[model samples]
Target chain A: MINRRDFMKLSAVGGGAVFLSGLSQITQAAAAYDDFYFVQLSDSHWGYQGPANPEANNTLRKAVETVNGLELQPDFIMFTGDLTHTTDDPKERRKRLTEFRDIVSDLKVKNVHFIPGEHDASLDNGAAFKEFFGETHYSFDHKGVHFVTLDNVSDPGASIGEAQLAWLAADLAKQARDARIVVFTHRPLFDLVPKWDWATRDGAKVVQILMEYPNVTVFYGHIHQENHHMTGHIAHHSAKSLVFPLPAPGSQDKRTPLPWNPAAPFSGLGFREVEAEDKPFQLKITEFPVTRA
Target chain B: MDLQISKGWKIGTACLAILALVSIGAAHSAAPKTGKERVVKVVAKRFIYTPNEIILKAGVPARLEFTSLDFVHGFKVPDLDIRVDLPPGKVTTVHLTPQKAGVYDFLCDNFCGVGHEEMSGKIIVKD
Candidate 1:
C-alpha cells in the first residue's frame, strides 16, 4: 500500500499533472503500466557441509520450492553469488556448480540471472564460474528499467577492475539522467566493511560512476544478512544468504558464521522479491522465507 | 556495613593468586618458540609487496615482519594456515616454520586499493 509519504514522492516525480489529479486518478495512472518484479536469491553456498547449517544439502532445494510457491511468480530470478562453496579441486568445483545449476533449474521462471561471489570465482579466477554461467558481467533491459550485473568477486582481491569500470561508464552514457537503472553485484559498491572482506577493493570508483545517475539502485549479497545503506542518493541493499547467517559488520572480532540453533531451523535463510514500476520510478521490496515457520 | 577478613582467609587468597600467576607463566613458556629466528622484512604499498618472492629453509622458523606503507593490508597464506593484518605505520609480525618444502602463494587478503587483486607473493620453502 502506498502511504502518504509514498504518494507525495510519486506526485512530486510524476510532474504537475499528477499533483493536480485526484487520488483515484493517481491509482488509475499507477495501474496503467507494465510493472514488473524479480526475485533475488543469494549465497546459496551449495555443497557446503558444516555444523553451521545442518541442512545445507536441502536448503537450496527448499528455497526453489518456496519461490515456486509464490502466489505471483517474479518475471525473473537473480542469484547474486556464491552459487557453490569454494573447493580446491577444479573438478569438485565444477561438480558443485552443476549440482547448483540443476537445483535452480526447477524454478517456474525460466528467465534467470546470475553473478559470482568470491567463494565461486576467486580460486580459479572465475574459470569454472564462467564455464557454467557464461560471462561474469553483462547488462540487460527488462520492461522500462535497465539492469546491469558487475563482477567484483572474480578477482581474489575483490575488485571490479578498470576494464569493467569503463564498460559501465559507457553503458550509463547512453541513458538519460533520470533513467531507472538497477545494478546487481555480489559485493557492495560502497565500502561496507573492509577488514571483514565485506567491501570491494575498487568499489568506490564504481560508486562514483553510478552517482552520476539520479535514479540507480544496487542489489548485492555477500555479508549473508540483510543490510541497507546509502551513498549520496544511491541505495545499496544486501540480501540474506541461504546457507547461514553472519553477525553484523564489526560486531565481533572474527567474521564467523553464526551457529545454527536447533530450536529455530533456517532462521536467517531466505530470498526477496523486488517490484518496480516506472513513469515515476518506484520500488516495493518484499522478503520471503525459504521455509514456512 | 563492616566486613573483615581473617588472617587464614587472607593467606589462602594470596596463595590462590600466586598459583594462578604461576600457571599463566608456565602456559606462556610452553607456547611455541621460534627456532633459529630468520627475520624477513616486507613492505606493502597500494597493490604490491616489496621482495614479493621470499625464500626460506624448511624446518627453520622465520619471523615475517610486515609493514604497510600506505593503507591497511593483509598477509594470508591459506595453505600454510597463516594470516596477519597489517595496519599502516605499524609492524605486524608472524612466525612460522615451514615443515614441508613447496611453493606457497600468499596474497594481500585485505582490500587495499584499486590494484589489490594483483597484490600477491610466493614463499619458496627450500629443503
Candidate 2:
C-alpha cells in the first residue's frame, strides 16, 4: 500500500532490529495523588503496520500493560485519537477498532474514554469512529470534575465546526462553575502553521468556550509528540504517539510522510499517568514509559 | 537498482541517474569543506527530535543514523526529499546526497506538535 512517495521514504532507511529501553520510573509520588484518577493514551494507530514500529499493534497492548500495573488505578483512560492510519474503507477501520477493543479486553480497568483523529475518521468523517467508540464529542462527570471531548477531527484535519461549537456551548451550560473541566481532542489549538498540517481551523472557538471555565485543562494528541502549553486559563497537553515521532514543525520544507525506521518505534512513546484530586477537581500527569514499573 | 532490464525504464533511469550523479559531482567541486560524511546522532523521545539540525557535505550521500529514546519519531528532510519513521528499539540509517548547496531543512513531518514546527533543523551542507 505504499505509493511512490510513501515507498521512497520507506526504502531510504537502513534496516535492523533496535531494542530500546524505556525511561526509568518517574513519580513525584506523594499524598498529592490521593484525589481523582485518569490515564491519557494517544495515537495507537492500530491498523498501521510497518517498519517504523513493527510492533505497532502490540505496543497498544503494552500500554494496556502499563495501565493495568498502575499503583493508583485510574478512574478511566482517555485516548485522544489517531486509532488508525489512513484508509476510507469502513471494513478496514472497523477491523482496526475491533483490534483496539480486543487489546483492552485484557485490561483490568473497566472504563476507557476515547476521541478521534483524522485517520480514524477518514471513512465517512469519523462515522466509523463514532460507531465503534461511541460519541465523538461529548461530556460527562465523575465526582467533581467535568470531562469534555470535542470533535476536532470531524472535518479535514483538526477542526471543530460551528454546529459542534453550539453543542459544546450547550454542553458546558450544564456543568457547574466550580467543576474542573478537562477537554480532549486530537490537534493543538495554537497556530502551529496553517499552511502545512498543524493548526486546527476552528479550535479557536472551542478555546473561547473553554476560557469561560475557571480551572480547565485540555488534553490532545495527533501531532505525535509531547507538548505542553498554557492558553490563559486552559492548559493544553499533547500525548506522545505509541507509533513514531515527527518533525517539530517546518523542520522540513514540505510536510511529507516520515519514513519507516526499522530499528526502533517505541523510542518516543510514553503514557501520562494523570491522577485527579476529586475534592478540588485537580489533575496531574506524570509521564512514564510502558516498561515494567 | 532502479536502473535496468526494461527498455523504456532503463533508458529513463540511466539518464536520470547519470544526470543526478554528474550534477552532484560538479556541485562537490566547490567545497571549502566543512566536513565529509559525518556521523549525526538524533534521539527521539516523547515526541521530540533532539539536536535536530545535522551538518553535512553537499553533493555526497552521507550516512545518518538515528534512534528514538522515548517514542516513535519521523526524521524527514524535505529538500532532500527523505523521510524516516524512527521507532524506539531500533537504529535507522539514512543515506542522502544533497546536490544543491545552501541550507536544506528537515522536520518532524509526522505532526509531533506543540513544538513540532520548532522540531526542525538544518543540514548545513557546506560549500
Candidate 3:
C-alpha cells in the first residue's frame, strides 16, 4: 500500500525527526548555549480603563499568568513598548509605570527588556519612561546574536535621531558582517503608511544601516497586529498588542480601536513567542492569543 | 406768559432728543464688529485623525473643533501651540491664526493604541 509518494513522505518525515533530534543534542551539549527563546509582549497599556477593554485591568495580569504557566520557560521577555497608557500628571505616570513593573515582576523570567512607545515617550520626551526603564535605546549580545533595542519613541516626533543612528552604525561596525542581528523597536522602521503616522521619520536611514549586515531581523509592536514586511534581506515582523487591537492600515478613514466583543472578550489581544536556534536564520515565531481559563 | 412757557418746553424737548441720539450713536460705535470665522471639524478615533490633511489660508483665523469617535484622544500642533484633549463624546475647540504660509504637522499627542504614532495629519497654510 505504500506508493512511491507515500514512501517519499515517510522518509522525509523520518529524516526531519532525526535531524531535529541531532539539533537538540547539539543544543544540549553547549554549556554556553547559543540557541535560546524569548517572548515579546507589547502595548500592555497597563492603566487603560475603558469599555474597549472591559478586562483592561486584568489583561496584563492575565498575560503574566499566561507567561508563567507556559510549559517552556523563555530565556527573557522583551516588552516592545507602551508599557503604560500615557497620563499628563507625572505622578500618575510614575505610579502606572511602577505598577506595571510590579505586575510584570511576577513573571518567572527575570530578564525583561523594555522599550517605550509613543504613549510612554511623547508626553515629556520620555523623561518619565527613562526614569523607570532606563536608557531608551541600547544594545546587548546574547549567545552570539547581537540584539539592539532602539528608542524611536523617546523623540518628540517618532524618529530615530542622528545620535542613535551614529550609535547604531558604530555598534554594528564592531560586529562581523555575517553576525546575526535582531533589532527591536516600538515603531516600524519603514514608511508603512505615513497618513496613519505608522512610518518612522528617520527609519529609512536605520534600515540603510541595517542592510549592511548579511543577517538581520526586526521585531516591533506598534501596529497592534501581526504584520510581516521586508526591506532588502532584512525582515520586519510586528507583534500584536497585549491591550487592544488597531485597525489595519488605511482600512478606515480613521484608525480606531476595534471594540471588544463581550462574547469574545479577548479576541485580538495576545503576545509573541520567538525561538532562535544557534544557526543563522533559524528563528521560529508564534503568536498566542489570551484565552479565559 | 403762554409764549415763554411754550418756548422753554420746546428747548427742553430738543435737548432730550439730542441726548438720546448721542447715546444711541455712542452705543453703536462701542459695539464689537464680527469678523469672518472659519470652523474646521476634526474627528479623532483610535490611531488616525479624520481629514488627515487640512489647508488653511494664512492670516485667517480658524476654529478647529475636535471630537473623539471613541476613546480619549489628543490633538496637538506643536508649531502652532495648539493642544487639546478630546474625551469621548465631547467636543474640544482649538483657535488658531496662522500667520506663516507653510505645512504644519498636527499629531495626536495621546496614546490611543499601537497605531498612536501614526495618528497625525498635516495643516497646510497658503499665503
Candidate 4:
C-alpha cells in the first residue's frame, strides 16, 4: 500500500512507470520484514574554529543530545563524513578525530557507522582516520538492504580509484539486479558544481556501475546542503552539515559558508532521519534542525 | 532567395569573419608587447603558495605562470573566471587583464594534503 509520503517521494524522482511496476513486488515482500530507519549526520567538522559557526564547539554535542532526545531512536546512525576539520599537522588531525569520536560516542544508538570526508582523509590518505575508524570504506547488510560505504576522499584527487571500483563491481555482481542498495560517501558522485570542489572526479564511473541495479539511492555529504539529483533512475541525495551551511550550487561565485545570523542561531545547520521501508522499497528522509528555533 | 543575393550574402559573411579573425590575431600578437604586460611566477607545494600576494595595474594584461612543486593544485580566481590546473612538475600559464580595480581572492581548489582550505591568496588590482 503506497502512502501519501511514499507517493510524494516516488513522484519527485520521476515516478512514471519503471519504479511503480516494481512497487507491487516490494510491497509483497513487506509481509516478511519490518521497516527500519537510520539517522544521517554529516560534516560535523568538530575541530573547526571559524566565524561561519560561532557555536561550532557546542553544536556536535548538542546534536548528540538532540538525537538522544528523539522519541524513536534510529537502528543505526551513519556519519557520512567530515567528522573533523582538516589539519596540516598529523597530530592535530588525530587529536580532532579522537575528540570527534568521543563526542559522538555519547549518542544513544550503539550501531553507528562512519566514513571519511575530504577534510578527514585527504591529508594522509585516511591513515589517521583509519586509526579511529576501522576502514575508510566497507559494505554491510541490514534488513535486506545492501549498504556500501565508499572512500572517495582518501585520494587527494577526489577519486574512488580503479581498485575500489573493481571491488565495488565485484560486490555488486553478487547481489541480484533488483537488490536495494544505499551508498554513503562524503562527496557527491555526480559533478554538481566542480568549481566548488563538490564533485568526485571519477564519480561518473561509480554511477555507471550502479546503473545496472534497479533500486539504488546514494546519500552523500560534502556540499553541506540538501540536494537531490537523478542519474537515470537512481537518486542521489546530499545531507546538510552540522557545523555550517553552504549556499546553493552556482548561486554565488564562491562556495563560502552562509554568514551566521545572531538572531537565528544554528540556522541552516541540521541533520536527517532516513526511514527505509521494505514493502514499497522507499527511503523517506526527514530533515531536522540542530536546535529548535 | 535569388542566386545573386545568396552568393553575395555568403561572400559578405565570409569576408566579415576573416576580417574579425585577422583583427583578433593582431590584437593578441600586439597586446603583450606593449611593455605594460607583467609576468608573475607562482610555486605551489604542500598547503601554501610562494609569493601568495600579487599586484597588478588595472587594464594591464598579466600572465600568471603556476607550477606545483609537490601535489597537483588548482589556481582558481572565481571573480575573474580563471581556473587553472597545475600538475606536479608542469608549468601552466594563464593570462588576464583586470578590467576592474579591486581585490580578488584566489585559492587552490584542488585538495592538496590537509591544509588545502588555507591555500589561498589575493590578487590586488590597483587603479
Task: Highest lDDT: give the candidate number.
Answer: 4
Runs of candidate 1 with Cα error greater than 4 angstroms are: A1-33, B1-127
Quote each prediction's TM-score.
Answer: 0.67, 0.60, 0.67, 0.75
True-structure lDDT of candidate 1: 0.75
For each candidate, the DockQ is 0.08, 0.02, 0.06, 0.25
Whose DockQ is higher: candidate 1's or candidate 2's?
Answer: 1
Stretches of candidate 2 off by over 4 Å are: A1-34, A254-265, A278-281, B1-127
**DockQ rank order:** 4, 1, 3, 2
Mind giving the per-residue lDDT tens digits that candidate 1 earns over B1-127? 1211111111112112110000112112322454566778889887788989989887676666677887667776645545556778656655556666777667787554434546888888899
Per-residue accuracy of model 3 over A72-112 as CA lDDT, tens digit each: 67788999998998776789889999999999989999999
Instruction: Find the number of clashing residue pairs for candidate 2.
Output: 44
In terms of DockQ, which candidate is stronger, 3 or 4?
4
Residue-level lDDT of model 4, residues A1-293, one tens digit each, is: 87544544553343111122122234334123457778899999988999999999999998898888766678899999999998889999999998998998899999999999998998789999999998998999888788999999998778899999999999999887777788999999997876567788789999999989878899999999888888888788898899999999879766778999989988888888777765467777777788642
Per-residue C-alpha lDDT of model 4 across residues B52-124, encoded as one tens digit per residue: 8889877677766677898778776655545556778646655566666777677787787556766888888
TM-score of chain B of each: 0.72, 0.62, 0.70, 0.72
Instruction: Give candidate 3's error at residue A170 in angstroms.
Output: 0.5
lDDT of every predicted structure (CA atoms): 0.75, 0.63, 0.72, 0.77
How many clashing pairs does model 1 include? 0
DockQ of 1: 0.08
| Interface RMSD of every predicted model, in angstroms | 9.8, 8.9, 6.1, 3.4
